[model samples]
Target: MNEKEIQTEIESRVQKKLSDLFTTYKTDTDSLQAILKWKPVVLMIGNYSSGKSTFINELLGQDLQRTGQAPTDDSFTIITSDGSGEGLIPGSTLVSDEKLPFTYFKDFGEQFISHFRLKKVDVPFLENMAIIDSPGMLDTVTEKDRGYDYMRVLGEFAKLADLVVLMFDPHKAGTIKETYTAIRDTLPESSGEDRIVFVMSRIDECDSVSDLVRSFGTLCWNLSQMTGRKDIPRIFLTFSEAMAANPESYSEWKEERNQLKQKIQSAPEFRINHILQDIDRQVNEIKLIAEAMNAVARKGRAKLGNTAKFGFAVSLFVFFFLGVILKGMTGFPEQTFLAALLGGTVQMHHFFVPACGVAGTLLVTSLLFTKWTFPRLRQKARNSLGNLITLETDYRKNLWSKVENRVNELLKNMRISEIWFEHQTNLGKIVKFLNKDLQEFYERIRKIK
Candidate 1:
């Protein structure tokens, strides 16, 4: 299949899965919708003056993004093709635009709004894919300075991106705290390593071949510390195409630059894997929640059983004591009391009235147990829910803990006994989709050229 065909199929599968998820989970599917609203994104992140904008301009063959020696651009720009006449759209308007996928970005407040933009240039390359140019990372800045969570915003983009370009230059060499924190803490642990492509941009800055080698080694050491990976990932060495005139030390890495460009062009092919991996992770999270709900349901039913046993026993005792009171006061149904005594003489005809009285008393006791005693016990259990979650494995316990609030919410709206059955049924449906339907779609994409 071609890139367009692959993208169409992925969207179709994700839509089907999301429909099932919405029906089963009974929550907002806004997050899922956001991912599909935009085309495949290749997010570019790096320290200041890493020539990220330069590389982007060279690829597009147009200077749409601002570039300089020092942080020339502070805004996070979403560059794409504009069918409605090429222009720059402000963030305030962009968030409100339904056609765009950045509505959720409004939560970052006016500070971020002031710093975000959409650069819609009429480029042929953008017709196939989109590029996100992040604000240049600096060692001195904090989340407070931006009046919003910068790394968090970037992380959201990272989650949405099919490929992430983490670029560096000889000057910084992977020493920035912002870069380290992003690698270590922001992106999803399992898939981030595979999705991210490291780039040593501005390779011409190196004084000699030996100098570039030193910079490469430094980046490797820093990456090992940040990612905790024993083996180094492939880092693309590239410089701006404009630097083609007598690059003293950069002459050796020209082939590497061409290879990097080729890799970037092939980014659309990687989208198939990213889409599948994202779906897998989301389904697994739901599975954990289902298992936890099942656990809570089981615990609740057992407690109800115990309560019924104890409550009914006490009710029976009360009925017996009341019968004795009535017999002493008015000698009502006197035959039952004497017959119940082992030494009393038997009178079958006289036993009829007492038998009728015992039946009525037991009926009243059963009603009280069902209405008041059972409900009260369930209420108490609801308040102390921690005692009810019986899980065997540490992984299950951890997953349950993360989704504990969701379980509590479900229980609050309905009986725990009902939840277990519903969750079990939903889990069966989800597992089948993941194992069979989702697998078929993924295999088709993998088989694509």
Candidate 2:
């Protein structure tokens, strides 16, 4: 399908899956409304001191986000499109300290904390596309508890991203592995519609133009090897500091900056298309799995239902059989024994009493057996049902885990060329092979049901 069509399909699938899950909890209405009004989200992530904040300022064409000569030990500074920045603390808000001016390195640590309560910011950018300015990874001060908390939050938010911009400093070029690990460790295999783009930030720090180009090339190669996505786009070198320092000095840099802006502007739609197709595939997989699991559960429930009916029928049959046996043995009617039993044997004349004795014995035996034996039967049936439910749950979980692992491996092994070709190629043989594989997967799952 074309990009727009694919994107529409993906959005539809995502909406449907979200709708179904939320509907189970009766919360689909609000979620659906939110989806309808959803905007593109771009997440800015990189190691600390990678000029991420500086880049944000450049992007906004103002010193909106804090940038300084040294690294600031702040948590995430989420700048939304609305031109508002706020600190995000774990479970509280500092309403009294809203719109605090960006701080420099000298203003880091508890000094800043004392001035502001970290509350999430809702700004104009949130209306169309939200930009998350995450704390740098691998900061020198590792002991800070808040940094770890910030890392955790960033990881959780990674799933919400449409694109991830990995900003790298040329001076510390060797830490790309650490950078990739920081991101990969936190994100799930199924994070939707996200693309990782490397940015060789602070390019002006390079010795010369040639040095900058070489550095960018090396960065691209290293990232390609590390990510196993050789077809992934090359790194985009940026000099946010230079751009901020003298917006007019480098016309070429300015042109490049504009190009990057255009790329980002178009990336949301580009990614949405791929994400939509992926989501459709994922939804189909999930539906098949769910159906199989439900089938197993239904079978177990049906067996339990039958067992319950059988137990009831057997109990009644036993009671009736006891009545027959008592009538045959005592030469007295079952009703006489019941009446005597109800009347309490206080006036028993010997001959009549003996006549009711057999019925009483048989009735008492049946009652005792039914009371004692049926509990074990019921317990067994319940245990069987419980075991089936547990089995089905475990099976589904394992299957999902396997799928996740396989997909992750596939992504990790994917060559840059393959990803590019995936978009470019229409080789009939490869298409046929993929179709066959998909069919095989469906058949295997059907067998599982």
Q: Go through the candidates in order and give each one's C-alpha lDDT.
A: 0.70, 0.49
Measured by lDDT, the strongest candidate is 1
Candidate 1, residue 280: how far the Cα is off, in Å: 2.3
Error of 2 at 340 (Å): 43
RMSD for each of the candidates: 4.8, 14.5
State the number of backbone clashes in model 1. Answer: 0
| Candidate 1 wrong stretches, greater than 4 Å | 1-20, 23-26, 83-85, 171-192, 207-211, 241-246, 311-333, 337-408, 417-420
Cα TM-score per model: 0.79, 0.49
Stretches of model 2 off by over 4 angstroms after superposition: 1-38, 81-127, 139-144, 147-149, 182-194, 241-251, 266-271, 274-449
List the lowest-lDDT window of 10 residues for candidate 1: 183-192
Best by TM-score: 1
78-103 per-residue lDDT for model 2 (tens digits): 44543455544431232222332222
